[model samples]
Target: MALLVEVHVPLTPTPGLPPGEYPFPWIEQVEDFLVDLEEEGAAESCDEGTTFGDYFVFFLVGATEAGLLAASSRVAALKGVPAGSFALVTDTEAPEMGTGRRVGLPL
Candidate 1:
């Protein structure tokens, strides 16, 4: 199963670091976590980007439920993380279809 792991952060984040630095701590935090998880094969694919003008969204795939929970916990525990900065894990599988164009497709 695939999961979309989202990490939302401020537009201009300065977590645990001063301003004017590249690779902001918040971004580095998630990337570092993914790097470790990737070594363990807990995560295989990820797409990180910004959104809503107030957030940096991370879309991850191939993570187990427990793995995602662990990652979320880590993100939640980071120092200097803003209140609005949070993590969310969701299943990425397509929903079962009972109508529309999916009605006639083979399972």
Candidate 2:
């Protein structure tokens, strides 16, 4: 199973630092939180990466139900991050197998 977790983080530019500094600390915090959940049998594997922008974005992939739950909990906890802002979303399974279609006109 594959689960995609999207995180949107708000960032404020520092006086001397570059605009949108690395969210390493926030990342570390998230990683640590996820690791703890994994240790508690709440996750299978967690792969995290970042995207650049005025707001930080994080993508996490998990391979199990526990993993998904862990990811969700971690994201929820980030609501209080002192950063500029934050948002999180998780992928859900389709109602039917291979029954969903993309809504768009094929060019």
Candidate 3:
């Protein structure tokens, strides 16, 4: 089966976080949320090339039969990621990601 992956690469830190530099300190909290998902076997991190823009360090999580975007979205709700800035995609249209329809955010 095609790997189910979720992208959670936000362009900026959540508004709740204090202003800081690029690769903002609050990014860690986001990763922590996803990593917790991974630890729970909800998803696994992927090393794929799907740059939304130019420079932004984020994760691409892949699950088994279903993409964990919904789970990640729920996590974002608790973690303070901006709802407007968030998005989700799957590999339904392409073997490589980034071509899926928008439903959701980064891993």
Candidate 4:
């Protein structure tokens, strides 16, 4: 079964992302990364309830530990993304994206 990975990216300036303003570009990068994962048969990002308030919240479905780890590495390495940006890994699927564990990027 696949797990739900909720990636949280900051929209305001922070220690991780120096000038976290360009939320659009950052989000586009994230979407592109998810597409890459899907093309590689790694994961699939669901875009039903994505939000853009204080930060960005998106949903990705993949395997367990390894999948989350790989995704984390990619997100952390993103151009404007910060290694401090984190993701919430859940055993459940979308819609109910339940509370699971918190893992830092580049894990």
Q: Point to the candidate with the largest TM-score.
A: 4
Worst lDDT 10-window in candidate 3:
48-57
Give the per-residue lDDT of model 2 (tens digit) for 14-99: 34446677634555665666677667765533345455555555454544534554555565456344344333334435342212
TM-score of each: 0.58, 0.46, 0.58, 0.71
Name the best candidate (by lDDT). Answer: 4
How many Å off is the CA of 43 in candidate 4?
1.1
Clashes of each: 0, 1, 9, 0
| Model 4 C-alpha lDDT versus the unseen true structure | 0.67
Better of 3 and 4 by TM-score: 4
lDDT of 1 by residue, 40-81 (tens): 776644655556456666555676756665665555456645
How many clashes show up in model 4? 0
- What TM-score does model 4 achieve against the real structure? 0.71
User: Per-residue lDDT tens digits of candidate 4, residues 1-107?
Assistant: 56677777666443443464543566677777888888987777766536645556767776566776677668767886644566777755435543667777766
Return the clash pairs for model 1, or none.
none
When 2 and 3 are scored with TM-score, the better candidate is 3
lDDT against true structure, model 2: 0.47
The C-alpha stretches of model 1 lying farther than 4 A from their native spots are 15-19, 93-107
- C-alpha lDDT of residue 6 in model 2: 46
Which runs of model 4 end up more than 4 angstroms from their true locations? 13-23, 93-98
